[model samples]
Target: MSTAPHLEAGGLLLIADESLSPALVEQAAPVLAQGGLALCQGPGSPSGPRRLVLFDGKLTPTHAEALRGEPPALLLATRASDGRPSTWEARLLGDLLRGAPLLPAGASRHRLQSVADISAAGGAAARAVTQAGGSRTAAALVADVVHELAANAMWDAPVDSRGQHRYAHRRSEVREVAPEDACELAYAVEEGRMWLEVVDRFGGLRPGPFARALGGWG
Candidate 1:
């Protein structure tokens, strides 16, 4: 089996249900086009590495189930609305379109092994942001996000032989992350975009649970 071609700067496949309102489609088209992304309707599978953007008013269990078996790269879901993409979504799409690294070129990389390391990495990222003329508030926000990502990567990531999360039920206490379980934190700012990435070696995130959690689908 051959892999699909990656979505490039002008190649996006927007899938919508047949019952989706024309008003919503009108609202979404300009946003995608302005971002240099091509748009199409329905569920036709395109060849190559194309990113899949599903605009279905809101992501539901059905949508989540449809995407469950696929690899979770460059897949985005958005509500059908008149507004443009949110900042986070825009950045995500930008990275996908350009095939950019999660952390941009010249990023500062850190190997984090504990809560303290996560904190230090966040601080370093914030400092880098401020030094590059970004506002203090922006820097602080970036730091906070970095801290959260690190926490998730460290505490919520590890799985044992039985597919159980090692620290899933642990209380909020200081725990030392083992060297082998360390996460890589990287951040960089380029061309008015700040890129940050926290990588845990174990790719344990599942789409269904994540979607249900976010959408309150339970």
Candidate 2:
């Protein structure tokens, strides 16, 4: 009997980071698709974990379905103020995906109140994956998604005085570690799955652009 050739699994990679321009995201789609991967502009992705890249958005039922199984290596990047990818970030994501163990059974859910808490919650979620013996790629994905959501919320959410402006200018301290001052949110971890939710009183008042973006990620 002959063994079957290893086939690259197909899955979805949702982009939620509003900071990332549609053009940049559209450009990466081809590369990812070539490897049997795809990019979604909303929260819902396929049921199997091919490669879901969440930028800054909510998780829809479709997105949850796509994340059910073990995911492929994750590629995360740190961007500059000008919205360009940083060399260090690119290398870091590449290295992690190339070499990271897999923690097969852990699911986490998070709910944030303010944008300030996004990074912290994400970092915590990633560390959870590491502690659970899962691949760092999965952990990185969770962190990156949280980071993206936080960024969008801070910039887009409705504010009392400034109309949803947390950081007028990019601050090194906030960017490096968002949870420290990002706000107190809710999160949970169990089994091998993770869900993060960002809630605000103003959510009902007006849905921002990120909400629409999340829908497309799926």
User: Distance from true position, residue 2, model 1, in Å?
Assistant: 27
How does residue 203 of candidate 1 score in lDDT?
97
Report the alpha-carbon TM-score of model 1 versus the true structure: 0.66
Task: List, residue by residue over 14-99, the lDDT tens digit for candidate 1.
Answer: 44433343344435555656554555443345544343544444655445544554554344445325443444565557666667
Error of 1 at 150 (Å): 0.3
Best by TM-score: 1
Q: Per the 3 Å backbone cut-off, how many clashing residue pairs does candidate 1 have?
A: 6
TM per model? Answer: 0.66, 0.35
Off by over 4 Å in 2: 1-118, 161-183, 204-218
Q: Which residue pairs show backbone clashes in model 1? A: 4-48, 4-49, 5-48, 5-49, 6-49, 7-49
Question: Which parts of model 1 are misplaced by more than 4 Å?
Answer: 1-13, 17-51, 54-100, 214-218
Please, what's the RMSD in Å of model 2?
Answer: 15.8
